[model samples]
Target chain A: MEHYNMNLTLKVWKQKNTNASGSFEIYQVKDISSEMSFLEMFDVLNEQLILEGKEPIAFDHDCREGICGMCSMYINGRAHGPWEKNTTCQLHMRAFKDGDTIVVEPWRSKAFPVIKDLMVNRSAFDRIIQAGGYISVNTGNAQDANALPIDKKNADDAFMAAACIGCGACVAACKNSSAMLFVSAKVSQLALLPQGQPERESRVLNMVAQMDKEAFGNCTNTYACEAECPKGISVSNIARLNREYLSASLSTEE
Target chain B: MGLTGLFLVTFLIVHAGVNACIFINDGGATFNAAAHFMSHNWVIRIMEIGLFAGLIAHILQGLLLWKQNTAARPTKYAMSAANENSKWYSRSMGILGSLLLIFLVIHISKFFVGTKVAMYADGGANDASHNLYLEMKEEFQKWWVVLIYSLGVISLFWHLLHGFQSAFQTLGINHKRYTPLIKTIGVGYTFIICLLFLLMPIAFYFGWIQ
Candidate 1:
């Protein structure tokens, strides 16, 4: 692949802390290689900032790969830049031109407030998960993996739903800042499995209550969460979540 | 919201079907007969009560949901650009629904209230002589009324375009094979239903029907 070096301008969000008023700070970096990942480019800029005795931009990132869900940059009005189904860390510099002025900010949602520059406190997700997102089993030695004899379709569906990494991109992308997709993905994964049957009724109810308590918006069925999901999580999981919630709410005997 | 939305969808079809009776060009006789039947039949009358209740519940729930959604994001983004992520109508249901609510009030007053008044004056539902078709004709003759009705139908068109498939999705009827079919049916349904409703006033104003 052919590579080119480009000088670019970045307008990044800067704040001392969550309570501080924030603003965009523009920094020009010369000779940015097109082959570098988006975060690598940020690394180059940070190195320059530190050498000049300035505080570098603070952004959340663990794996340079897309799996960790730690990276949460909203670039140029998108959750993860211009590419579809691409994470911020996975976004390459090639997507931008030499003279591009990229504006980078943190995920904007009430449930995921900014902690610092381009880093939001996503612990609400952990709370939502803690509410129900687990299965209870009796204490025993490990059973054979094939003992369950799960249906192939159900297994595949569960696998797909399980792929959610708890990224807040779905909330960032939604007009209402809804977390339905993330909650639904978790709900659907458990709902499809036989192991998740014991607490099935209470599980959905508890998780959804937690989600509501966190002040995340209701799903408007816009499907934006699915579109921006780096894991390509389907909105059908949300449909499943709705199904679960409605059934749990309506059932009197359970 | 999903349950009531589906109910309203069914109601729209029956309502549109009755309105399509205007296209028969029978000088409003067929339309009046259908309207009278709808008002007089016990089952239909009972369903009408349910329909009204459903509509009220739907509206109240929608408002509450909108309030919660708005409060969820206390702070707005400096640069949203939300249209890049979702359809305009999907994000604007509150506005579209409010428009429809205004239209509904005008519509029910013109026909439903008139029918009730005539029924009471005649001392029974069997003897009520109000001609709703005539009221529609007179109303459509006013350009502003027709314009308002047109705008309402336009809003209905956009609302149905988003609501139909969304209702199904919320109900968990989504499937790889059936989803595309549902979406196609949704598109066709929206166009046909809105066009049928739109034709009523246009036909009255243009003298296509008596």
Candidate 2:
């Protein structure tokens, strides 16, 4: 790609802490290379702020390779910039033109409260996973990898569903702020595997109850969650989740 | 919501079949025959109760989901291109459902309740039970009523456009090969049913049918 420089203005959301009322603060950055990742541009702006003895903008990021899912922000109305199936860390300045004013904000959900600036507390996701997102098994000798023959289709689907990074993008993209996509991904992943069958019924029931308890909205089948997912997780997982939930609820009944 | 929605879809097909009898153009004769069968048959009557239960359940589920969804996002985003993310009809189910609900109330009050009343109170020689075809005819004669029915059909069209495939997907009936087929069938189903419904009011009001 040809390299070029651009000057731009960013409208960044600013907050002192969780209790403080947040607002947007405008800042300018000049001579940004088009090939630079969006976070690099932010780094440039922060470096300038440090030189001026002003507090730098705080944002969450690690493993800037888009796999960590730590760089969560809504760029110009999208969950992770303008790219499809990409996290914010993968977004490059080339996506924008010179003189463009970009708006940035943290994920807006009651379940995820802003900690400071663009960083929000996503530990709610951890609690949901802790509720019942895993399979429990006896600690014994390691079983052979091929002990159970798995169908290729089922294995592929299980792999796909397991790709969810718990980035909270699905919730942010949803009009209802629903976490169904994330939860469904987890549910379908386990439900599709033979090893996960032991706790299938209780797993779905417990995880869904936990998701609802977490203050997330119900899925309305908007398809936005699938669209905005960085891992390209399909809404079919949600369908599977619903089916699992229904059957589990029935089978558990006396 | 998916189960109830699929039940209602089946009900619509049965309803459209019965209503299509009006196209015989025999001055409400065939339509009244079908209408009488639907209203008087004990089995049909029992199924009607189940249909009502399904409809009520679907409506209740929709309302509850809407409330929970709204509560999920207590704060609005500073800037959002929500339209860019999802289709308008997919996001506006609540508003569309509300419109359909109002239309349903008027429709049930006009025909279903009228039929029940007529069934109880016989009007001399004119069997009120079989007079549903006439009731529909007279109702469609009013221009405003025709407009309301047309709007209701319009809402139904959009609702089914999303709900049909969505119901199957929610039920986990989706597959790469079959999903496209279901979607096509859904589109065709929505167009045909809504068009048939729309044509009924237009045909009555335009003197195309007495």
Candidate 3:
């Protein structure tokens, strides 16, 4: 792959904390390598800000690979920038042209309050997981991997559902800031397998109740979550979640 | 919400089909008969109450959800590229539904009031004098009324385009194999239903149908 160096302007959001007012701060990074990941480019700009005796922009990142879902920059209006089905850390500087102005912000949702510039608190997701986090297992001995004999389709679909990284991009991408995609993915991964059968009903019902309690919007089925999701999680899981919720609500004694 | 939305969707089909009897070119004879039967039938009358229930439930549910959805994002994004991922119609359902609501008020006032009133006045007389087809012709002749009807149908078109497939997804009936078919059917249904409804007004206003 051909690599080139380019200079660009960055319009990054700057906020002190969740309660403080926020605004955009512009910076210029010179001679950025096209090979550099988007977060690396941010690191260079932060270095410049530090040398200039200004506060370095605060943001979040963990594994620079796409798995951690920590890099939650809403670049130039898109969830993880212009690349389809990509996380911000996997986004490279080559996606931009020299002298382009890049706008970066954090995931904006009432549940995902801005902890700092380009870093929103995502513990809302953890609470949602905790609400529906139980599965009953026969705990006598370690069973063989192939003992379950799961249908191939169910296995594949459950694996796909398990790929969600809890990035909150789906929430960022949704107009209503709905967490349905993330919640649905978690519900589906368990619901599709026979082992997950015991708590399938309660899992969906409690998770949905918790999600609503968190003040997240309901899904309108715009399918924007599927489009902006970095791991290519499907919207079909949402249908399954809805089905599970309906049955659970009707059947549950509680 | 999905259940009520689908109920309204089904109502559109029967309304459009019964009105399309005007296409028979029989000088309102066939059209009036169908209209009379629809107005006079007891089963349809009971279902009409259910239809009102569905419509009211749909509106109340939609308003509640819209309020919650709005509250969910108390702070507006400084910048968001929503169009990059979803269709504009899918996001603007509230506005479109509101527009349709206004149009529905006008429609019920113009046509439904007259039909039901006449039915009540006659009291099982089977009065063919009502001439609902003639009423359509007269009502649509007003350019402003026809314009309102046109706008209403346009809103219905966009609403159905998203709501049709959306209802299936919400009902948890979506499948990789059937979802595509559902979308295609949704498009076809939207076009045919909206076109028929739109053309009815234009045909009367322009003297294409008597």
Query: Chain A structural similarity (TM-score) per candidate?
Result: 0.97, 0.97, 0.97
Q: Provide the lDDT at A37 for model 3.
A: 96
DockQ for each numbered candidate = 0.65, 0.71, 0.83
For model 2, what is the error of residue A161's alpha carbon versus the real structure, in angstroms, after optimal superposition? 1.8
Collision pairs in model 1: none
lDDT tens digits, residues A1-254, model 1? 77999999999999888889899999999999999999999999999999999999999999888999999988888898889988988999999989989888888888888899999999999998899999987859888989988999999999999999998889989988899999999999999999999888898999999999999998889988988899999999998898898889999365
Please report, as a residue range, the 10-residue window in candidate 1 chain A with the lowest summed lDDT: A245-254
Q: Local distance difference test, per candidate?
A: 0.90, 0.90, 0.91
lDDT tens readout by residue for model 2, B1-210 = 888999999999999988998888999998888888898899999999999999999999999998888888887888888777788898888899999999999999998887777677654334553478777888888999999999999999989999999889888777889999999999999999998999998999997887
True contacts kept of each: 0.64, 0.77, 0.84
**Tens digit of lDDT per residue, candidate 1, span B39-155?**
889999999999999999999989999988888777666666667778999988889999999999998887788887777765765455578888899989999889989999999
Per-residue accuracy of model 3 over B1-210 as CA lDDT, tens digit each = 899999999998999999999988788999888887888799999999999999999999999989999998887877788899999999999999999999999999988998877767768353656888888888888999999999999999999999999999999988879999999999999999999999999998888876
Error of 1 at A90 (Å): 0.5
The candidate maximizing TM-score is: 3
Q: Please list all clashing residue pairs in model 2, or write none if there are none.
A: none
